[model samples]
Target: MFRLILEEEGYEVHLSKIAFEEVHEVEKLDPDLIILDIKIGRHNEGLLLLQQLRMYRPTMKIPVLICTAAISVIREQEEILQHKGIPVLYKPFDVDELLHIVQQNLLPSETKDC
Candidate 1:
């Protein structure tokens, strides 16, 4: 679903099944933005991945959007993401909202007209 939506907006999207795969792909692709589901397969694994990214200098400045449905659990980690200026999108999100967020993250600062 996410891949399709992103592709429709002209962004090349890659899908990774697990945290390890995601890290591998991110290193290989150096994507303009990363949309991560906060749970991945293990509880908080996505958050763990984000923490690792923060520690790594090469990937530390890349934009990230934390996607999740577990609002209650997310509230606990909200401050962490907020402090990093990472955006959060709850599950069952509208496509338009998703597209808008993607564009905002991927567009260069000089090119952002919205």
Candidate 2:
């Protein structure tokens, strides 16, 4: 669903079912932004992956947007995520909200002429 939504908006989306083991591949892709889900196969695999990605210089500066249904886990790491400038969208979020965040992350240099 998320991929379809983004694609419809003219953005290319990639799905990685085994993202935990493909961090290097992800760096190679050099995506403009990453929308990560905290519960990737395991309860907190996404968080662990996020930590690993941050440690590497290649992926440290890429924008990461976290989308998850795990409120408890989010609360625990909210401070850390905030410090790293990462944003989180809780599950069941409105599609408009998701698009808005994605645009904000991707089009930081574009300005609307008024």
Best by TM-score: 2
lDDT of 2 by residue, 5-105 (tens): 88888777878775558578778777788889998875678988898888888988778899989999999999988888899999999999998988877
Using alpha carbons, what is the TM-score of model 1? Answer: 0.86
Misplaced by over 4 Å in model 1 are 21-25, 109-114
| TM-scores for candidates 1 onward, in order | 0.86, 0.89
Give the per-residue lDDT digits (tens) of candidate 1, residues 37-80.
88887677888888887777778877888888988878998897
Superposition-based RMSD of candidate 1 using all C-alpha atoms, in angstroms: 3.6
Off by over 4 Å in 2: 108-114
* C-alpha lDDT (0 to 100) for residue 23 of candidate 1: 55
**lDDT of candidate 2?**
0.81
| Top of the candidates by lDDT | 2
| Full-model lDDT for every candidate | 0.76, 0.81
